[model samples]
Target: MKSNRVALAALLGLIALPLVVREPYFQHLMIMVLLWVTIGTGWNLLAGYTGQVSFGAAAFFGVGAYTAGLLSFHLGVSAWWGLALGGVVAVLVGFPFGWIAFPLRGAYFALGSLALGEVMRQLATIWESFTQGMMGVLIMPTFLSKLPYYYIALALAAGSVLVVRLVLGSRLGYYFISIREDQDAAMSIGINTTKYKMISLSLHAFLTGTAGALYMNYMGFIDPHVVFSLHDISIMAILVGIVGGVGTVYGPAVGAFIMVALQEVFRSAGFGALEALSKAIGGGFMAGLTKYVSQAHVLAFGILVVVVIMVLPNGLVGDWRKVSRLFKRAS
Candidate 1:
């Protein structure tokens, strides 16, 4: 009960953030964090809970992005409509793909998902007439201010978390866990493993696709490479799930916040803190250090992942007891 109050307070604080800090750049970062939370939550539903690791989150993301972009480009409809329809389209795509990929197990399923994402990227690039190919799609954004986008993203993230929590409390949730723990055991108990797996995939795809649609509207542009990049979208989703605590309800929320902060720190060279220090120090050494740090964000990310895996294999939330013990020892 005390934890719930603290969580509610934190959420309320986040909801009131834009009113206090009106900076567009910070708001943009918050938006990204919320978006990742949504995607991470969906990915967790399928991979973390159902024991199905997917590398094709980018496929659904790209499909929804294109769905929104295309509607505005061709039909002259509001791209906003895509927010509602995008997830549906993603489900349609995932249904057949899951049917085929469900037969594969473990690493093979992961590979199949990776291949699916690659195929989607290739198709988006090759089909020039329909998708405009690599030229990309551009659209006018509805809102001039970042506040609306931020709030919408926050709501979406909150909704995804709530839906997952409710599902995990139901009978289907147990079935998902059973399959994840031992598919053979789940099947022997009269559970249709394939159907449940497909259901998980569909839910995952829908949430991811909704996020993609949001991205299209927020960013005002879309390209196959940007949306469907394996490392950027797919692997990041996996990292968010793993780093946050895969099977835990609130893990992705915490993971998303940490990963985004880490990404920005390296991407911006410690958010320009290093550059300021370099100027104060007045030396080539400091300048060189800043340059190296800026260029090594990816390396830093890799090291962070490795360190987290080694130190807290189950993630921050999942390993709360270990973390508390470490703090106690330090004190």
Candidate 2:
């Protein structure tokens, strides 16, 4: 509990730093980081908490983006209302997805989610009349500014983290951890595995979808490729969770920071340096190194996921607990 407070304090400090520094570019990066973190927290609730490995977050994200985008474009609705409606639409979709997929366990459930996402992406492509198809929808000039977006994204991220913290500290959270450990056992002990799972997933989809609405408005554009990209869902959801330490409150944030920082570094290196670095590293070095870093940000994210899973099976916060126990023993 004390540790959690400390971690929260650190997060507050990072957010507050921008207020004093006042760099637009850095603020933009910070906005991206917070958005990913918020989405990751939502994913963590579903996969990390409920033990329902859903890879279809991109689908829900796309749904939210489109819902919000269409509403804003056609009805002249404000983003504030669009954000809420996006979440509502996502939950409506999530209920059906969860209802069908929850029957399948483990890999089967994951496969079902991946398929659902693909189907949604195709639909987004085909629905040219409403979605504007591959051309995308753009957010025109509005009363909002970058500072408003920065704070809004921060609030979303903070709200996600807070909800995760609240859940983990409650009885419902215990039910989730039990289900994750052993669904059958959780059921035998009188916990309704299905009920808990659905609740977790619904909350997960809602938060992540809301973040997507914010993302579209922030970018001032939305396209099928960008909104429904499989890569976007995987890196921001799974990879972030894996690297930061899954099922742990602060893990996703740490993973987001590391993954984003690495991307910025490699991106700043430029294409020529990237090619030279690739060649200098050779096949074996490249093969091993690629596990830790990749073109843009995805590969680096993949590597971090692998290393964390291999080295710290329980995740960063979980491992920290072990280390803390060791120190106590030594004392």
Q: Which candidate should be chosen as best, given lDDT against the real structure? A: 1
Model 2, which residues run further than 4 Å from truth? 141-144, 270-296, 321-331
Ten-residue segment with the worst summed lDDT in candidate 2? 287-296
lDDT of 1 by residue, 40-141 (tens): 999999999999999999999999999999999999899999999889999999988999999999999999999999999999999999999999999999
TM for candidate 1 is 0.96
- lDDT for 162 in candidate 1 is 86
Model 2 over residues 244-313: C-alpha lDDT tens digits? 7788888787767766666676655442465567678777765445434445466655676677778777
Segments in model 1 whose C-alpha atoms lie over 4 Å from true places: 280-285
Score residue 66 of candidate 1 by CA lDDT. 93
Candidates in order have lDDT scores of: 0.93, 0.80
In terms of TM-score, how similar is model 2 to the real structure? 0.86
Cα-based lDDT at residue 7, candidate 1? 66
* Residue pairs clashing, model 1: none
